[model samples]
Every structure is written in C-alpha cells, then in structure tokens.
Target: MFRNIVVGLSGGVDSAVAALLLKRKGFNVTAVFLRNWDTADETGKCLADEDYKDAEYISKKINIPLVEVNFVKEYWHEVFTYLLESYEGGYTPNPDIMCNKNIKFKKFYNFARENLKADAIATGHYARSSFGPYLEDYKPGAKVKLLHAVNQKKDQTFFLSQVSQESLQRCMFPLGEMMKTDVKKLAVEAGLGVIAQKPESMGICFIGTRTFQNFIPQYLENKPGNFINYETGEVVGQHQGIHCWTLGQGCRIAGSSEKLFVLRKDIKTNDIFVVPGTDHPALFSRILITSKPHWICEEPESLIDSWTVLNCEYRFQRNEKLCPCRVYKSSNNKLIIVSEKEKRAISPGQFVVLYLNDECLGSAPITHAGPSLHSLGEGEITSDVDDNDGLLRASTV
Candidate 1:
C-alpha cells in the first residue's frame, strides 16, 4: 500500500518476482541495478553486461524506471579489505555479512532515501517485517519487528542482524512471506523473460568461485609454515602458507595414513598442529563469550542484576530456541550464555545472535567458546557438545 519504492534488482528470479509483487500491490516501484563488483577479466566475461541487460529487460517488462548505483569502491575498501586483513591476521572472515551491513543496507539504503527520494527500500531477501503492538513501557513510534521468512531453508535473518532498528523501520522484504518455489512460479506466470530460469549466484564476494588463497596473494605476501601432529611435536606435513588454510578444515596430512584436522596454530613458532580425530571430544564446548553486542530490543539499562532468558542463533537457517543469558560489562562488555545444553562451534570472528522466541533480541560477536571452532592463528579444531543441542553454527573457510 506504499508508493515511491526502490527495489534492488539483482537480475535474478527473486528480485524479478519481488518487483512484480510490489507492482501488484499498487506501489510505484523503481528497480535499481546495484553494481557490486568490477571483474574486468576479458576471457572470463567478468563484467556486468549480462546482468545489466537482464535488469533492463525486466524493468521494461515491469514498466518501471531502472537506476544504477555503482558500489564497487565501497565493496573493495570496506568488505574485501577486511576479508584480506582477517586472513592475514589468522582469523576467518564473513564477507557476506559485511556486504549486507555496509553495502546493501547502509550505502544502498542512503542512496535510495536521499537521491532517489524513495519512501521505502525493498529487497528480495527472505525475511519478514511487521508492526508490533506497542508496550506501555515501550518507546513511542517503534513500528518495526523482524521475523523469519516463510521458507525456513532460505531464511536470511542472521546476515540481517546488524541492520539498525531505524533502517528496519523503512525497509521492506516482499518475498519473506512466500517460498522460493512460489517466487519462481510467479516469475514464470508473469511471463518474465530469460531470468525466469536464471540460476541463483552462490559465488563469494566479488571474486566469485576463485579460492580465497588466489585472491589473498594479490594483496598479501605468503608465509610458509610447519604442519605438526597434536600429540607429538613431529613434523608430518608442510603448508604452502599458514593463511591458506582455515580453522576446522579436514585436510589430508601428506606422508601419513592418519587423517588430521587443524587443532592449533602457533604464529610465533610458525607451527600448525593437527589432531587425530574427525570427531574429537576436546573440540566441542558449551559456553560462549561474545563482545560488541548490538541489541535491537530495549537496551538493558546497565548489566546490573539483569538475569534474562533469550533465544539465540549462531548462524542463519537455525531455529530459534531458549537459552539463559546475562550481560556483564564490568570488564569488556559481553553477553554470557550460562544455560545452553549443547556445545557449538562458535567461530572466533562470526556472529552470535540472541532471540526471544522468533523475534530477534540482539546479537554479538563470538569472542570465546562453549563448543566452537578454536583457532590460534595457524590452525583450528571444531567441538560440539552432546549431539542433540540446538545451537546453530556453520563451518566456513
């Protein structure tokens, strides 16, 4: 029921169907082609030509104006730079979360509101939004409440945890209530051109399918190191570089029949220790310590005597569940989960989101463990508490 809306058009079926849905709702929708990268490899066709053409065709079919916003510089400076630094510093990074935070929501949101004069910005993200009944003690004019998307498999709320409450108020996600299959069916039914069968892009940030190592060499000089066994400090393998491998990787140890997983990294000694078991018990823990907490709910007035219960998700696609937590800022502000039944692979640089039932309470950066992927710069080891605990965490290199 809103007019003057700006929808991000990715030249894919999801955004294409989103534009159609907004049009059906009688909104003055304008599609914008966000130029996220500049891959100029001539042989690889590493450019945005096809995507631009698709956007043009879709815009024409939808009878809406199409705009282009170039964000290549921001992607490089903010997201890619951090990714490179995190690797060199010996920690895994999530560029996708950074992309959502700095690019899609922050920069893109500003452009739509200020330059395009849009009343609201919409995307094809699989998350829902609604206005909640205001509480007597609640702050006035708090109209935004984020909810999980209908298609549970495709839910993306984890990446969106960083979105400010102010931005969430003006943001809209039309595909949240609908399943991916339904969106595809609508695209075909609406007679959208070639994009009706376009495949979803699962490529890494800017560089696409190329290994992070390939791209890292362009920005960093490699430092080779020794790969040692956990029990004995005997050298069993040698790595091209310590930064090339990520924590939790089950890489084959050369010259040994025993498969080894990275357990610890000693940057000072340039040693990468490998453990023996794929299901090593020492790998999992049940306690988590997080820092830099971002609360979407009412900010707790100091951590004093605050014993509150909340639900948390360590990764997207995780079901929300109850966990007893307390915020303690007496020394380095952090959220401590005291009563989680399961140990999780709380990766050092990933996010830890808190929820109340389905509504997001807040989120924090995972700083320490209760079962997590432990990385000591040169190596990593994953641990899970009993097999039945519901804390959601995913392993990524």
Candidate 2:
C-alpha cells in the first residue's frame, strides 16, 4: 500500500471528503490547493482567495498540512492558448476538458509524484476506473481504463476523457461510488458542515462569474460578422464575433417576427447561418467527421483492423445522454461517426466522447459535422464510403 498520498482540495465538500477519507484510511495525507488562475473579481479581489481559505479550514480541521502551489504559467501555456486558438478558428472549445488533460492529470500528477514524493494522488472527481478506487486491486505497470462513477448525477468521466493512461493508473477517486447526498451527510458527520454547505462552483475556471459572451472579448478582438438566414441567404443582423455565438442556441438579434437559432458558422466569410426555430431540421446533425481520436487506453481491439466499422456510444456534451453511433473510415480515411438518431446542435470544435457501456473509450473533436438535416451546400460536409473505396451516400441519412 502507498504510504504517502497527496489529495487536491478544491475547497468544496467533494475534495474535503476525499482528503478526509484518505486520512481515515491510515495514509499520510497532505492537502495541496492549486492556484491556477490569477484573475480578479468585479471588486478587483482575487477570485480564488475564498476557495483557498476554505481549503485551509478543511485541512486544519482534518489535521493535515496544507500546501499552496501556483501554476499560472503552466496553465496559460497548456490550456489558455488552446482556448484562444479554438475560438479564433471559429469552434467553441471546452477549456475544462483541456484543464483535466493538461493540468490535473499531467502537470499536477507529475508535481505530486516528483515534488511531493508521494506514491499516489487523489481527487474529488466523481469517476471510477478499471483499477479499483484507491488502486487496491491494481498491479504495477498494468493498464487502466476510466469508468463512469456510480453516482451518475455527478459522473465526470466526460471531462476526464482526454486524461493520459499513466495519470489514470495512479489517481484515486474516493467519491466514485458515493452519492452527493451521502457525501454531504458524511461531511456533516465529520464536523465539516460549513464546508459541506458551500454551493458548487460553475463556469470556466478563469472566467469566474462573468458570462462567456462578456469575458472572451477581453482577450480576443471582436471581429464583426453577419447573420444570414440559411433558407433565404438574407442578412438578418450583425454579430460582434463568431466567438460569441454557438450552434442550436437562441440568437439574440433584432426585429424578426420569429427568433433565430444558429445552423452553421462560416469562418472564412465571417458569416453565421441561422434557422427560424430551435426545432428546425437544419439544427439536427446525423453525422460528423472527427480528428484522430485520443483513446484513454489503446484503441479498442474492435478497431485494430483497418476499415472496420465499430458500433459504440457517444456524447458531445458532458451531461448529454449517450447516443448510439457507428464509427467508421471515410473515403479520405477520415474518422466518421453516424448517429442512430439525429442529434441537435452538433458543433465543430466540440469533442465527441466515445463509450462502451460504462468505460470511456476515448474522444475526438468534431471537425466537420456531416451536414445538418437540411444542407446549406457549404462547408466541409462529408459522405461515408465502403471498405472498397466506393462512395456510400450518407446524405440520405
């Protein structure tokens, strides 16, 4: 068993409980509070100061030493730069995913193992793995697969889809099988009721309380664009930037008998195509082409053979229901996914996380959504092909 364990306390009930559990399990626990953001609130006060104080309270009461580390430079290089590029490229990217991939799992993992000289690390994330929680059943140098938490309501595997294999093997999730209600109950029982009652934090970590539409303009110039109706190609209104809009959401434009929703965004033309209603046929996508996938483990054996079509489940949004899909090779050998049912608002730059029952297989960003149900006849629309290289018209889907 690992003697020295480092637990990341986020100043929430979740991480507090995680560290408490590790201490109770007879491990030497050290609490580390990471300061990843250097931003200030509207009042010009450091946004993370409160979180740090709460973390200190939890560590003090739990009788564990607390340490603070700043990763502002590492965070900017790994996560922030990617966010800027993805937004400038006209794709809405999720920074939280990048944070897990680069910060929590990679940077933080290395810090704990080398700097802290710890045998293992733990977090409050509601995720499990093929390697048991706390790694009681893991063998050295063996493979590990991230799995869905028993608490489906709080399952965070989608955010962890991009984590590396090494990180998965050494991390522990004490809350994997515990319910939120039970976790809070335990926190209260442990005399940490003040920590247990804190409201869950939300939004981009650095953005803090500011709306996305507002916070982004501070970093990137607001390039002007036009909202063109998909059916008529008539300019409805002007938008500050394509970065401000997302597919399948209400378009806040002026003077229309009906409200508009985004259908497609053309980065080169600086134009956004819109539909009349939220349920517009153009809003639904049945297929999407993706970049090469980043599998948490090795590529599934089912896909080891070239040109093999694999049946799997996928979710674009973290909380989205797992929808049935088929992943196969395209005529250009691109990774293509066709859904059993048309999905609404499938956007470019968003990742499609693949799954097999409970285990997270991997994820790939949607490079080109095949074509909305109602095609605009523009952009990189795709059609699937047979193994023999003949084009199979996926448009009829």
Model 2: how far is 123 from its true place, Å?
A: 0.7
**Tens-digit lDDT track of model 1 for 1-397:** 3468899998888888888888888888899998988775325865576688898989898899999989989988988888887777666677777788889888999999999988778888888776421111223476566777777788777778777787677777888878887888888888874687876777574565667668667667878888998778789988866667765567787688878887656666667777777665445545566666776645555553333334343432244544544333323355555334444334566666665556665566665564343332122432332121222232111
Clashing residue pairs in all predictions, respectively, total 12, 0
lDDT per model, in order? 0.68, 0.84
Candidate 2 lDDT, 1-397, residue by residue in tens: 6889999888999999999999999999999898888889766878679899999999999999998989889999888989988888888798899999999888888899999998989999999978887889789888998999999879999999999998888899999999999999989999999998888878776777778888889888999989999889899999988888888879768888899998888889889999898888778767777777889988887676655788989999987788998787644545678788878888878999999989999898877675565663332234433222422444222
Tell me the lDDT of model 2 at 9: 87
Task: List residue ranges in candidate 1 displaced over 4 A.
Answer: 41-43, 132-140, 300-331, 338-345, 370-397
Candidate No. with top lDDT = 2
In model 2, what are the clashing residue pairs, if there are any?
Answer: none
Per-prediction TM-score to the true structure, in the order listed: 0.83, 0.94
The candidate that achieves the highest TM-score relative to the unseen native structure = 2
